[model samples]
Target: MGLRSFVTDILPTTLHTRGRHAPTLVGEPEVETFAQLVDKLGYLSREDLKQVRAAYKFADEAHLGQFRASGQPYITHPIAVAALVADWKLDAQAVMAALMHDSMEDCGVTKVELIERFGSPTAELVDGLTKLDKLQFSTREEGQAESFRKMLMAMSRDVRVILVKLADRLHNMRTMGAMAAHKRARIARETLDIYAPIAHRLGLNQLYRELQELAFSYVHPWRHAVLHKAITRARGYRRDIVERVRSDVDKAFGEARVKVEVSGREKTVFSIYRKMREKHAGFAQVTDIYGFRVVVQSWQECYLALGVLHQLYHPMPGRFKDYIAIPKPNGYQSLHTTLVNPLGTSVEFQIRTEEMHAIAETGIAAHWLYKVGTKSSANPAEVAQTLGAMWLKSLMDIQRETHDASEFLEHVKIDLVPDSVYVFTPQSKIMALPRGATPLDFAYAIHSRVGDHCVAARINGEPAALRAELKSGDVVEIITNPGSRPSPGWLNIVRTGRARSKIRHYLKNLEHEESQALGEQMLTQALRAEGMALPPESAPEGTSVWPTLLRWSGNRNPSELMLDIGLGRKVAAIVAKRLAQLMQEQGQRPDAVTLTLARYAAGGEEAGATPPSLVVVDGSEGTGVSLATCCRPIPGDEIQGYLGRGEGLVVHTGDCGVARRLSARDKELWIPVAWSEEPVRQFDTDVQVLLRNDKGTLARLAAAVASAEADIHHIDMGDEARGETAELRMRLSVRDRQHLADVLRTLKRSPSVLRASRVKPERPPG
Candidate 1:
């Protein structure tokens, strides 16, 4: 078929549904069989065909009594999926997997059984396509997330897994009309949100557009029908214009002596709908609905054809793009330009070589197509690698860092956006990132180490913020320092799954380490209070302490025990008392002098025994020690520590009402904590200010706080403020009580200040 006829006829509608009255794929008046499927297997060897036929026969027998909602035999779905896979010219194993993809899910066929019949590779491919319905999940969303995670992990290992699964999903989406409205809508939404984007990311434009169209139709039948009618009427109205453009393009290419095939292209219904939604326009206002593709034999002819088209029509200014020099993230290459016709309508033209054309339509699947066709000089493996290797590897990387299925699914969705911006490294190496990606994302894209240690960035040879959005063609230089690590705040600005995962992983590990350290310190103090030293990790000749302690605590290791203590999962004093008892049984006695000193330091408990030493709050501990926001304790304030379950130690003021309420309940979880003599970090405290209503009054108050060497963390003003005075609430970070007092005095001296005082903690009466 001619290129124009191929695109206009076969490409627009690659998937379709058949009503109950319509004929099946095999034909009317005949049962569904492997005859049509076998016809598409010309690229496979005779041996491969025999294996595929065996799989088909086994699947048919397994599904003998099963029928679909449409009353067709269940085996037809597998056959149809296999035929679609074969159409992509995938290998025999992929075809076989497609033929039996549903066996494990529906017919109780196990992976081992398939492995015994087919090879391990074929069985694995089939297994990867199966859903996770056999496993119990708390929610449907969780189950679906895990199933996608499994399939994606398998696809990362072998690309054919996804090819077969996409075919399966495509076939399912095509026949979804037979399902109930709610089920069809749910599946259609999933296909549109996930499968279609994945198909586009893999460069299977043919399947991508078809899946989108079909999903949109099912998801919004009313809108679909109305748009379908509008598109049909528009096609009829513009038939003469399309023919005129085709003739003019052919004549121009002929006169220029460039060998090219010209074809007319129309946007899919989904794409048209998306454009309308994005532009917020009506159907009649949408322009450039029709386009043309010019396929050539070589890259040089592609440029020549572009020149001829630009000369034949008035090229729209700033509407041209050279994708040949910088292909899309999916490895699609073409030169795109919009030109104005004599009727003042805009029409887009895409010029590409035949190989580019194939890749454009089939994407990564074109690798296999080229391997069988001898259509291009490029190696199939290299083409596939270039097109999708990084993205596939990213899936595994994300899985490694993310364990929760829903979180993993969220990361995958973040990566699925098809739009991208291509930037450069300091060495001029090109890196393509999702649009709106920042310098931190670029750093992670280079290496996780780089992202973890990234301190600053320079874009286009000038200093730039790490969170600055990158642009195409900009050279990004990342500066790394050994002391610098990813901040929890970095998650707010990063735009890629890989960067987000890496940052979260780093923060989690850091939190674990800090928690272990805090737990160790607390345990040491508790042991000291008992007049005993913390046991060594292992003894030279005697029994080791950790194994017995871990066994008693039901922890895997000492660090885990410490983590439990640090996170309030276990109490340090209780564990220390138990350890002391175990040591005393082993004939170890406490020193008299140590007991006397500990008892004196602990204020000499009435029972003539030492209590656990007080925990010191220095404000330097990271996530392992946090101040309770309810009381906002500072260094000079009388404080106590509460071990919140699964959360690190929470420091609160001695008189905090929240602390009193909790003390009335689980009092043992609270620990005597004292402020360090010299804390290294500032603490946040709230202050209320009544000021005159004036424009620059707020600014003056801020300057007063800054003059006193305190920083305002946040400010709040009531919207009901009126008349002469306004109430302002501010959270300020100050060194201690003395520094805060200085800030309050400075603020009270201001002329606009009517009143200023520290906001007292709310203490509800019991």
Candidate 2:
């Protein structure tokens, strides 16, 4: 008999008769049995099945003493999972991997052993399924993340690895009820949050639905039971409605001269619960509970059937979606239209070709059906290839960038969200984005460089802010600027984790460069204070100076030595002493009197230098020190330094409220610091100007500050009182005490100004 006849004959037995104890067949009924499962191995050659069976037998023996919590033979689980793969019509290697997925982890079998037995391809698949048992993690969250990372990296190399893994997870979820209560909930929640969505994104509707129902049962048992009972009762009452709809669809298709098969579909319990919860309604309020699907012979027939249904029933306005015309990102295609049925209830109808229907129902697994047939129009493998390629490519991209499993999982979670808005590029190429993604996300989705240089954007030919939230069907065109750089604030608005992580990575590297430059300066200044010029541009002759420097700083390399000094991990003075000693041993000496003078002068300079030892506040050369943004310090303010772990000397005013709390709590991090003569760079101070209500008062205040040769970096002007007076907090830069005094004088002279004073901004407590 043909495969189709075999499928038709066995469909009932495979789907419905498994749990039922039926009477034994008499006189050898023509029924497909477990032996047929072996016969179907023709799709994968008999020899391959023999090898797979050998591996299965080995796994069975390795798990001989083991049994599941349900008291079933441990081998039965692998067989069931392998059956799922067989149902998917996977190639021989995938089948072998599925059969031995648990061997490495549960049976203590090694990849080497599997390789020697089943060959390398099968062994690699088994290895990919193994967890990182030997590694230690700081927390369960960390370990889980790392494990996900490894799986994704492995998946990038072979799409079959994840497919088999997902199949394994699906089987486990189906049987999760046998596990303990807490374990069930955790596993179910993970399945719902991670696995189910992944399955959906990969177009695995069959696995997706099963996983959802399984997870829903455990995540909300009471709700699942209630919904299941309600659906069961509702199905009984709606039996007439279903039959009528089916008859109506068939008759309508007959009238349209379109041959079609009509079927009734009921929403799953999990779907019903989700609609109720999401819409904030009771179960009765949820519509679209009853749906009908029309499967036809061709795409043209699908449209004809859709027309026939709409002509028969009134289609709800704006409730129709023609995915066949514009497929979803996951390659799901169907013509969906919701209409008001004869019963005056909203009924959703999905019309598609038989092949499309198979894909819609079974997703990538529909490839199995085509493999068994020779229909010219049916090519499920091509469909699976198209849908799976993009998803696997993205997984590969994420794995290449992230090594931490938790972080990889995070990226996957972000990528897998079902809520996506479809947008168009300037050239009209469609792109789907996670909801709430901004223009920056669109740029990054196109390319990393586009995101990095994206300065502005336009939606529908009108300029929009970079942070503007994108919606479906919008035509987006990113505006690039050569000098634009990503700001720290972008982290707050960007939705996609890819954009966020890339921006953060770039900024971190930029900060490191700045820190390195600052560290080099500090080291040079410290050496100068020690009455020595910088060592020869290269290491001195015959000294092995790099090793000597490493020994002195207790570091691995010169870069690390400099980074330590720059980050205040080691004192500059101590490093200077070591450098001086090294210099003296390298045939360099200083006069006793010159050294004495240098000591006294250096002491005076140190006393007057910036509070942070690394920061040099020169009154003359506008170059060295900077006040911390966290707690901005000005001249004449009592200040202290915070060796902020990785951050170099952060100067905070001593009497500032924020600094006091940080000092009280983190005394070990606090370090002494002072100012230098002729301070070089400008200092920023906050000055609050309380001005009488006036029109041009704000502009005049800014002009006055500018006249005083002080620049205003930022300004906040708003009503502080209910009426009349308004307060303006201005963060302005000044050269020194004299410049700040001049600016304050000018501001005080303004007629509209009621009160003007430099106020110390309060900082957050440590």
Tens-digit lDDT track of model 1 for 573-673: 99999888787777789878877877776775676754444677787777788899999999889888898988888998988899888888888888888
> Count of backbone clashes for each model?
1, 23
TM-score of each: 0.90, 0.81
Model 2 scores worst on lDDT over the 10 consecutive residues at 1-10
lDDT of 1 at 470: 92
Tens digits of lDDT, candidate 2, 1-766: 1012211221112111121211111112321223544654667776887887787778778888998887877877777677667777888888788878898888889889888888898898888888876689888888777777777666666666777888888767665556777887898899898888877887777678778876776777766666766765666677676667666766776677777666666676788888888899998888788776777788887777777888999999999887887777766789999998889888898888766766666676667655422366755545566567766766766566565667668778887887788889989998878899999999988887888899999999999998899998899999998877787788787887677767766666666565566667666767766677556436453144557877767888766777776676776667777877887777777546645655665575567742225455453211112467755676666667765667666777877777777777777556556676556677888888888877887788878988899999999876455558888889999876677788888888989888888886585555
Q: Local error of candidate 1 at 107, Å?
A: 3.5
Off by over 4 Å in 2: 1-42, 368-386, 520-556, 564-601, 605-613, 616-630, 633-641, 660-759, 763-766
Sequence-dependent TM-score of model 1: 0.90
The count of backbone overlaps in candidate 2 is 23
